[model samples]
Target: MSRRTLLQNAAIAGAAAVPVLLAGARSAGAKMSQTAVAYQGSPKGSSKCSNCKLFEPPSSCKSVAGDISPNGWCKIWVKA
Candidate 1:
């Protein structure tokens, strides 16, 4: 293969690997803190973390860090 073609292929491979590498690094590092996030006070008329699929029951979240509240709300909150 030409040098330019090889370089382009390597660049493409590297770019595709970026996300996977970052994901692994993140999973190995400290988790995100819910305190760092600005959660909404009270549910949006009827939406809350508890009812959300990401909710982890009691006080935890699947994608959020720190203690999660069923009554709390966040931007990523989704209906369960």
Candidate 2:
């Protein structure tokens, strides 16, 4: 019951709760619509979601749901 032990226990508990919290948050937003993002062709570097690191092959994005275009661009687009 020392101060260090209490802090350690608190840290362990907090770490253990992180994944649960993240899972809940993820599920809470699981219904988000991909159409809301309104992806378009990038005007800056001509970058597309297909070339992004978050892009999932065959028409999907890690951050986007539904059918996504290879040439589509969004606000969260990042270079691969």
Candidate 3:
């Protein structure tokens, strides 16, 4: 294979591996939040999602800007 072709193949392989590596990293960090224990409150009360007040849906968590299980909670939770 030409040198350019070999380099291109290596680059493509590296790019493909990146997603797998990231997926593994995400799974390794798959853990529940500690905020569910109760409102410990952020050190400055600024990290609590419950205090943000912009958290809509009232049931969905807005802290992560993703699907946050209701069973879990975060410092940014706000009451509706």
**CA lDDT of each candidate?**
0.76, 0.72, 0.49
- Give residue 44's lDDT in candidate 2 (0 to 100): 34
Q: What's model 1's lDDT at 1?
A: 89
Per-residue CA lDDT of model 1 for 21-44, tens digit only, reads 645745786454565446765787
Q: CA shift at 41, candidate 2, in angstroms?
A: 6.1
Clashes of 3: 8
Q: Estimate each model's TM-score.
A: 0.55, 0.52, 0.38
The candidates, ranked best first by TM-score, are 1, 2, 3
> Pairs clashing in candidate 3?
48-75, 48-76, 49-75, 49-76, 49-77, 50-76, 50-77, 50-78
What's the true lDDT of residue 67 in model 1?
74
Query: Any runs in candidate 2 off by more than 4 Å, and if so which?
Result: 1-32, 41-44
Please identify which of the two predictions, 1 or 3, would achieve the higher lDDT against the true structure: 1
| Residue 70, model 1, lDDT | 80
Worst 10 residues of 2 by lDDT: 29-38
- Predicted structure with the largest TM-score when compared to the true one: 1
Q: Which pairs clash (backbone N, Cα, C closer than 3 Å) in model 1?
A: 34-65
Ranking by lDDT: 1, 2, 3
Per-residue CA lDDT of model 3 for 1-80, tens digit only, reads 99999999999999999758645744675433444334332333334444345344554343344444334445444554
